[model samples]
Target: MNHGDTSRERGRRGATAHVDTFARDHLPPPDQWPGLDLDIPTPPGQPGPPGLRHPDRLNCADELLSGPPADRPVFLTPAGPAWTYGELRARVDRIAHLLTGDLGVVPGNRVLLRGPTTPWLAACWLAVLKAGAIAVTVLAQQRPHELATLCDIARVRHALCDVRAVDDLVRAEVPGLRITTYGGDAPDDLLNRPAPEGPYPAVDTAADDVALIAFTSGTTGRPKGCMHFHRDVLAIADTFSRHVLRPRPDDVFAGSPPLGFTFGLGGLVIFPLRAGASALLLEQATPRQLLPAIAEHRVSVLFTAPTAYRTMLDALDGHDVTSLRRCVSAGENLPAATWHAWHERTGLRVINGIGATELLHIFISAADEDIRPGTTGVPVPGWHARVQDEHGDPVPDGEPGLLAVRGPVGCRYLADPRQRVYVRDGWNITGDTYVREPDGYFRYVARADDMIISAGYNIAGPEVEDALLRHPDVVEAAVVGRADRARGQVVVAYAVLKEGAARDAEALRVFMKTELAPYKCPREIVFLDALPRTATGKLQRFRLRGPAYPGGDQQ
Candidate 1:
């Protein structure tokens, strides 16, 4: 292998970087992309600045890692010493050198990154982008077959992984993946390798160059990868984090999401870095661990799901959460009860937002004075949103319809025919049903497909779930439509009971009947220890399509 630069430079200038074109090969047809017609919003009353450059000229790594104080700590990890920006920069540069020089990585090469949210994992993500390669990040909990599927989708040949977590991946025998480990005893461990002497400049590539290919679990349970350009990375930080969340240099951010999730990447990595703020990462950021850590680290900004906020509400009494200034809720609907309960206890407002992997991070959200507990606030600056019926015509205020938005950032699926399903007539149809009030706040209705048609009435499961949660005995709930011979489908509910609460399904059904329309009442109720949820704490309604509790039903 030659250590020369001109050959690699020629490769970078080519239509596709390196020999790995899986990301490009899989991009949906250009005409199928969501219409990015909304102009990027300028900061209110700010001085004139640099004009928006063509996306092909932007390098997100430079945007996030370039200007912070070198000695300031950017992240804190439980596994090892925290990283200062200076130390983090050194590591990123060295890794970029190793990848391009010795490991034969070139621009656009798809590099698989697997591990918990640690400093090394964070550094590896940045390094891949700095090397002009696209990063394919996956969760640590994923089993081999899932990893195999991602590997096939990405056509990945190289992996920079944590030895502690990738045993399943090593055994999977993915067709093209070549593995390299960190934090291992092996002599070839990538983390232990020495950095090349001197400086390393990040790759200069088109702003539209694919930087990350993030895979998300859609309604079908199949992983759908969203391709984001280098410019999309900074665009998310600018529109959502800079404009809405409003972080400062001194603020400390924390989250429950794995960095593999776009929410986590934006909340726990990109946003903080963009603001010159500090971020706290954990392998396990569940409520059980987060409460104490918040007090211990003085975490001011929190990013997590509504279920986590509900869980943290139970554990916050002893832990001093006085340090938290802002808590963001997404991934699932924020039950009004959960939002009110957290505020009553913590005196801190939980910001409600709706975001998708296709569009990057939180786009519809409100913070501080703008927060309305149950409503996902107005479109963040730089976006346009409206509610439309199934026929794609605008619906009046206070009526439920599909939520569609066109903005600076929007969906671009990786060669999936479902691209047509998500983007229609130049708008991204977020698979959600929402009611926009006259005040312009968007209320969460069921998913566009989650509505249950029983007999003649169309009922939203969230409405019934909300009513049931009002009963002190119900701690958690999920309602799904179950096929029935008498009715096309009936509303069936799965609920988790507060300890020692009555398990009588009849009484619970009676309570729901009083609060909701008779047709919307749950036809059957089943009790369980806990409701099934994704790692991000989203209720997996599909898992409850037929069975209530594991096998059949638990009436």
Candidate 2:
């Protein structure tokens, strides 16, 4: 065989460093993929945005590690310890050797990384990409069934898991999966594996090669695996982190979302390294744990859900969180009540955003003085968004319609037919019902499935939840539509009350009537100690819409 023939054929198909082509083979057909604007040529003599441009050969892990100074701290723990860029790169090199040499892994293999947020887990992710493998990261809290489902969808072959969190992975018993445990003194431990390395060179992969597959956090049905490219990882930083969040080299980033969630990955790992800043990784990031960690680490940037921000307001008496300069909220809609309360108490405006697993990170956001309390901000730089009707036609600025967006990065599902449903007419049709304001800001209404129609009127669930949250005694609230006899569907409220607060459903209804119209009021109220949420802190409204309980009654 002629050597030129083999090399030229691979280039003709798609330039890649992957020896194993499973991920590439399973990608959606070119016709099913969303329109990526990166392939469009820039006009002559006119320059494009710096972050949107990438060379034919690229590895994102290599790019992120190249820019920062050697001795700058890149990873910080809540306890007293830090890892400089030099130290992280060294550890990553050693692990890359262990993966390719000792573990017999090859390029394009799917490596599952399961663990809590720590320096070790982050290093494994970077090493996998450096070794020319596709990373499939799942939460450490995933049970055996969930783990198996994710592994099956991604067709994972190998795993580098935390020793303490290995039980579920073992129990999942995915066929043909090889596992290497870390954070233990065993001879077979990943960190203890034998390796010979000075500096492990990153794989020379194409910019469009698949780097990771992130499964959607299931709110309704099966989770679809969203495939992201090497350049897509850097695009989020160039657009959102560089232009909107505006991270500084001296800033310390912290968050409650798990690293498995793209929100946490962008905020905690990729953005900081890309910005030459340090990030504080927490294994447990509940609101109570975050308070002390924030003061201890002197965290300047924070990311979490709207509910956590509201809960922290009650417990902020003795904490010293003055180091916080910028705050970002996503994973769920941020109510106007929570935003105003947080501003009144701390004088910091919470930056509200809307992002999806398909899009990887936040695409619509506003920062600092550009923030409008209730509306999610305009499309981020390097992206375009509009409100469109069912036929993919633009709606009036003040009308509620589906939000469609197109940018450098868009959805590419892995061998899934839902790709057609998510991407239509060159736009990623996000299933959120929204109204584009006259000033171009987008206002949240509800999920397309969450909208309620009762007695010839359309009602948005979040509007009712925001009204209920204004009540002094209502600590948490969720609104869903229930089947009714007269009306096709009626609004129902699930609420959690504060300690010593009366559980009077009628009084709460009257309070809501004052804040909203009569038809918007909840006809029934169910009290629970806490609202159900996914591991990523997203509200699970599907669980609330299940069959009514024994004592359930209309107000």
Q: What is the C-alpha local distance difference test score of each model?
A: 0.82, 0.88
Best by lDDT: 2
Write model 2 residue lDDT over 1-555, tens digit each, in one string: 111222232244447788988788887766556655543233246345664668788999999998898999999987767999999999999999999998988999999999999999999999999998999989888899999999999889799999999999999999999999999999999987778969999999888789999989988788899999998999898888877898999999999988889999999999999989999999999999999999988999999999999899888999988999999999999999999999998889999999999999998999888899899998887777889999999999999999998777888888889998998866899899999999989999999888999998999999999999999898899998887879989999999998889999999988998999999999898888888788887888887887544223343
342 Cα displacement, candidate 2 (Å) = 0.8
Error of 2 at 376 (Å): 0.3
Compose the digit string of candidate 1's lDDT tens values, residues 1-555: 111232232244334443466676677766676666425556668433223334446678877899899988899876567789888888888888888877888788889999998888999999999888999998888889888998887778899989988799897799767788987988778877766976678777677678999988544578888888887888787777777788889888999988888889999999999889889888889888998889888999999987788777767777998888888988888889888988899888888999998998888989888898878898887777899998899999999999998776767788778899898877889999999999999898998778989987889989889888878788788888877768988888888887788799999988887899889988788888877666555677877774445433333
* Candidate 2: clashing pairs of residues: none
Among all windows of 10 consecutive residues in model 1, the one with the lowest summed lDDT is 1-10
Give TM-scores for every candidate, taking all chains together and pairing residue i with residue i: 0.93, 0.95
TM-score of 2: 0.95
User: How many steric clashes does model 1 contain?
Assistant: 7
